[model samples]
Target chain A: MKMPGFDISLVIIWALVAVLVVLAWRRGEGRLQRGLRRGFEMFLINGPRVVVALLAAGFLSYFLPKALIAEWLGHESGWQGILIGSAVGPFFPGGPLVIFPVLVALLKAGAGLPSVFAFLTSASVWGVHRIIMFEIPMMGPRFAAARMIASLALPPLSGLMAVLVIRLLGAPAGVIP
Target chain B: MNALKRKKASLLSEIFGVPFWVFAAISLVMGVLTWQLRGPATVEAAVMGDIDLFLFLVPRMLGGMLIAGLVQVVLPPEVVAKWVGAESGFRGLLIATVVGALTPGGPMTSFPIVVAFYMSGADRGALVAYITAWSLIGFQRFMIWELPLLGPEVALYRVLSVFWMPVLAGFIARRLTIWTAPPPSEEGTR
Candidate 1:
């Protein structure tokens, strides 16, 4: 999915940054100067997350068959569909950046609202990517496993819970997966 | 050069370095432990699912670091601050939320700013909401990549789904008493 027109925001952000850097450079306030340095450091720190999203974007595009997967989940069915949606949600690494769009498409393709919502929330909250990248590194496999068990269950719980809430609040303009 | 090397070496000293490498040992132990202690399918799924995802996700995550660097160099802090630092009510939360959606750098992007916000007396719930909103919504991504693949209806729904999430998150913050995220351990905790 390429929208050259929308790509302008990133380029625009850069241009704006350039202007701000110059303006701050001229003003030369001590606080702003320090902030500029910290800003640079932050860029260094966050640089990789961007790459991860892009790659996840690619992974989702290449590996997953969207409509088929949505159908397999039986998204239009009632409680069972929500169960299926939530169950499949966490394992798929694609974030809402991909999931929601896919969810909307799934809806058009015949998936139901609650199922889509369940999938979106589950995917967002309990993604598999971080289990691999984060859990293994910081906590090691044992703790990671514990967390995963707990986390995996939560996605469905969130969906089911959403039902309890949405049933009460009435899914104002669509709840997420 | 020697002094710089010493600094770098100390930073990567045994205490920090050993644990990182020893993750393999831990993973091995955990695998065996789970294999012995847990059921067959549990161990099998754990081995297949998490490790595969870890393998696939880490390199790209590392790559995401460079994009974050480029974004910072490109967008600077003040612009980020202006865009993200609106008031804490619904509108303010909305601005922060959408900005977070559009901008998709990891913790490294706003964690520092979040620290600053914390130091400057940001509300606890609002900060939580801000971070959540940012990670959940990738506005730039939706516009650039999603619209084309899924078409406008899906894309528009995508936008709308996220549109109120941040605000919802902020309001929900008041209700979620369990988010003991250590009260923004930094100044400017946006």
Candidate 2:
């Protein structure tokens, strides 16, 4: 059976966001609306940039060959998976837009969940955002290195945590195992 | 006129030409691999197809931004000095994480919001952690699309990740100081 609370949760994010926006708007008047509209316009005008980014992401991913990504750094153990996931994962980063559908395809093609989760999380976290915003200007080499080193711990930790949480929640027996 | 053309070219380059090298590098290495629009009418569907996802993401993203802008307004500069502000250390971190996980906007929105918190007196560690957590694990994101597909188990796990990440990031940032407080001056940040 499908879960009941997912929609409720989604609404929570949206509702909170709406409340914040409205409160901000009321206090500031049309200014709030104007800023948001400007942003919306940017999204509209930067249409090509967004498209190219996603398309390029897709094209590059296909070009790189998923198998190669797996073969170079794939691992079975949770710790190893995380380490590999963090290191190799960013090289293949794409936002959820590409990651999920592709992952579903991989699952159908018989990929394991542990690996899938590790890759998906890493895809967003360990990649360019670090370089784009966080690295260089904000955090110099030492800081960047520290963050990356810390992130390296995430994949395996996430894997272990998932298993434990699943077991505790009484995931449908074979749901996790 | 020619000067105008040059200026336009430079501006466009500034806006779009200078790519995120790492992003491109990552994409390229991968591209050598893989791979949003919308609507109702059949023609729109046919023409739009995959673009629907982008369309979907846009409104949600806009919704996020609008909220972020509002958050900026609600928590003004004066009340902040007199009221609840993220100080420093663990307490600051706890506040940051909560803000990060709960706040709805995208990185663009959340990042500025974090700065507002900082100028309002949030600690550096808290700012870093909040930005990291906000962008890294968007709770709203899971609700809309990922949770259904990833299922309860994975969704819960991802949410859990958000809880601890800020903690980890806070501690690390405190020690390193490799962080930025979002710019409170952005009118949106109020």
Candidate 3:
């Protein structure tokens, strides 16, 4: 489970950051300083939340037994598994760093594409924590509510798509145990 | 000056929001649970693992924040408004989708940008598209998180499946607003 790409991506990211920093500097007096200052401010603001969230995710990975997850979300579980995945997604309560590893764990534990797809889609679209924290406060409740209502069908739709893709491509057959 | 004041207020609220408290509480509870279930050694191990992850994440997160800040400073509001504003129509929605997909950072960074666009006269449909696109298939998230974790095949398939969603959601949102608007006569009377 070594991610060879991780190092390469990190290099690319730092390179981009350097370019942006130089560009900001060239933009004229005070602009680069202001941008860096703002960036640092954001880093500080988000630091605590990120730490706790990752800690929680670490605890979750330890707590959720691999065998139980495999039994509940495995390929043979069918649509029921997808439904459960969708239901659990919005309540998972973390960002990509937490969620993706958990998903990987589930996949390793034998969850199929449909369940995984449903879970990811639901979490991304309707994560309750995000809705309450970011969406309602930033976008206003009406906008958030409207978007939520309109996108309500996405999780199941994505799940169905996953099922079709699996059938067409014979995925989850050789991909997972 | 008024806008600056408003921005300060919002920033204050954001710092004190439920997200911080909720996440803290969750972490504490989970830590306790892990201690109970796996004993103190496992809990310590988990904390150490988190510290390792934190070291990896901090640089990337700071870089992301820097990029986001630079973009905000570089891209003129007028340009953003012209591309994704009320006057831009369906093209605005499309542009919004692309911008949202390309934008770096998570919701904490993005939602504020979306609000800035709203203040700059961006269309509701475009805003919807922007948020939807970011949530569903932001390129940064896919490249950094999904591709590495899920592998290329699953990531590609997931992206392909949800590719049209943001555009469709935006269109539907636009139509809903239109349908729910007051009649022209009623508006004149009011």
Using DockQ as the measure, the top candidate is 3
lDDT of 1 by residue, A84-116 (tens): 887777776534444543554455445555566
lDDT (C-alpha) at residue A76 in model 3: 76
| Candidate lDDT values, in order | 0.49, 0.51, 0.74
Residue B141 of model 3 has an lDDT of: 75
- Which of the two candidates, 2 or 3, achieves a greater TM-score against the reference? 3
- Residue B147 lDDT in candidate 3: 51
Worst 10 residues of 1 chain A by lDDT: A54-63
Best-first order by lDDT: 3, 2, 1
Candidate 2 per-residue C-alpha lDDT over A55-166 given as tens digits, one digit per residue, 9 for 90 to 100: 4433433334456445433333455655555555576533554566555444433334556666665665566654566454443455445555555556656656655665
The two-chain DockQ for each candidate, comma-separated, is 0.07, 0.28, 0.46
Candidate with more favorable, higher TM-score: 1 or 3: 3
Instruction: TM-score each candidate.
Output: 0.46, 0.59, 0.72
Q: Write the per-residue lDDT of candidate 1 for residues B1-190, one digit (tens) a residue.
A: 9998985576446324443334444445555666676655656665454344334433333333333334444556667666455455556666666555545454445556655554555554455456555555554344334433344444444444444555555655534434333333343223
Over A111-150, each residue of candidate 3 has an lDDT whose tens digit, in order, gives 7778888899899888999999988887677778778877
Off by over 4 Å in 2: A1-10, A42-80, A92-113, A120-125, A170-177, B1-86, B100-128, B138-153, B172-190
Candidate 3 residues lying further than 4 Å off, grouped into runs, are A1-6, A92-113, A128-146, A160-177, B1-29, B76-78, B86-90, B102-124, B139-158, B175-179, B182-190
Output the lDDT of residue A146, model 1: 36
Indicate whether candidate 1 or candidate 2 has the larger TM-score: 2
